[model samples]
Target: MSEEDYRIGLIHATVNSVQPILDAFQVHAPQVTLVNFMDESLIFELNETGTVTKNMARRLLNLVEKAVMSGVDGVLLTCSSFTPVVSEISHLFDVPMLSADVSMLEKAVDMGTRIGVIATVEAAGPTTTALLEKIASKRQKDVTFKTVIIPDAFKALQNGDRTKHDKLIHQKVQELANDCDVILFAQFSMARALETLDMTTTPPILTSPEISVKSIVAKISKKEIVI
Candidate 1:
């Protein structure tokens, strides 16, 4: 297939996730076409319930089904909280389906024994840590984690306070820098905090958007849509 023929679908649970991945694709694989599907209600429900309910899982799966039916070459779910559902139902689709943080977590496992996970949402902390542990176990690597959840930062972002959000995340990153082998921003939206960080003085920091975009692009290029 030609470069322009690659039509990837991005399934998002929040508006904040949209631009970071779009920016990533613009930098890394501009030739690929992107289709976005946003359902902000998923985040609202997750925040209210503090967990991924069955209804939430079903809704996410339905979105993926719609994306596949629309003829996308691959589907990338941008919400880290729904990652487990993606793992469970990815095989149902012929196209490659991925959780945004999987690629980043896989890389984190490879990079360090101590991984730091920073998240703006309460639920994302546990979800990301669990996924990281699972990835490390699969790779037979012993790993420990330090996870910090800043719900206030997410609230700030939702209220359109980008400076406060970035500042909060940046502070956490600095605190975790010396303690962990690598630090991971747990959400696509959190990737924006990278702009305020000086990465040279810190442990390697990994974010989902850029790394996930690269992973999907590679899979599409090789015609390997393996989950």
Candidate 2:
């Protein structure tokens, strides 16, 4: 299919995560028209509230509804912390929908039993950890999961210091490298740190952007008219 034929709706909880996903699309699906839906405040609110409340969930659904109504070929919920809502209300949309962390989680389980998840946002920790466990269970893979949040990292990115954010995540992933069979970067934005790592020494690092983009493309190609 020509890249021009694919239209994607990228739903994001933070603007910081958008560029990484876009960069992935450029390399993997450049012909696709990428329409982005972002709310930088959503992550702050979720962090403040400690969970996705009923109202917050409604907001997420409304966002996806907007994307569906916009006639996207597929929707990628690039925010790991918000995937549960997308997963829950997926039936509402006739189009294909995906959680950013899911494809990576499936790959992680297939790669090894002990998975280490590194997330920058506290709220994302529980959401991603649960996702990894769920996928592992369904695959009948005996997986042991551990999540470590770079408490200061997401805030740094939100505050406009990308260097600090990436440095903290890269450091933490390296610290956890020897402890687990494989290290998974929990949030979609963390894929940025992959370029800085030495894969020869660290455990295999799994990220969401490229893999998630591939999943969306495959689903849309099969269904032919998710929008």
Candidate 3:
């Protein structure tokens, strides 16, 4: 791809879930370009309590604002729990700013009301559950969210234990199959776990990559020419 072919800028706090999304995005939309960067401080803040802090949002905004200022066509944040800041950033920027969670949650709601949100971080599970419930109410769909936090899954990923992380996530998703109407992966970095695990027993699973990229593509195409 040439410099002129690349156009979209993706802002991520971490790279875990961004890998597969990039692969899929390239295959799904070959003409668009994606750029990723990390705010090292947000990783520490998220891991400290498995949640975002005031400082984390500040650091994230600094990176995302710069991406917008650089003349990118659109911005998609890969972090799920940072929706508060994501909402604020989307409004502040002229270009489309999207949340990885909101895009995927819309898809999940369309599938069913009894949804299971699985996340690597402790906070992501509840945060996503709340967001889905809100979306469901706004759409007037009767919905309930079942949240499961995969214990040690984030630690395994953080510790570089890919195999263990995959195993734990698979087990958690499997257990949820008995309860939820659909399974939704909450963290962006956990996308690899979906391909690694056998989700035959669980309901349909939704990830951030395709949903978010597609939404941003639609939002940008109307406002600017695609490279």
Against the true structure, whose lDDT is highest? 1
Pick the TM-score winner.
Answer: 1
lDDT per residue, candidate 1, 146-225, as tens digits?
99999999999999999999999988988998899999999999999889777887898889898998888777767653
- State each model's CA lDDT, in order: 0.90, 0.86, 0.78
lDDT of 2: 0.86
* lDDT-superior candidate, 1 or 2: 1
Q: Indicate the worst ten consecutive residues by lDDT in candidate 2.
A: 218-227
Error of 3 at 179 (Å): 1.8
- Look at candidate 1 and give me any clashing residue pairs: none
The sequence of per-residue lDDT tens digits that candidate 3 reaches over residues 114-136 is 89888888778778988898889
Tell me the spans in candidate 1 whose CA falls farther than 4 Å from its real position: 224-227
Q: What is the lDDT of residue 168 in candidate 3?
A: 90
| Candidate 3 TM-score to native | 0.91
| lDDT of each residue in 1-227, candidate 2, tens digit only | 55478888998888878989999999998989988887767888988988999888888888888898898878999989988887689898888899887888888999998899998888889888888888877877788987899879887877888788889988887788878999988887788878766678788888899999899998888786443
Report, for all candidates in order, the number of backbone clashes. 0, 1, 3
Please give the lDDT score for candidate 3: 0.78
Provide the lDDT at 38 for model 1.
83
TM-score for each prediction?
Answer: 0.95, 0.94, 0.91
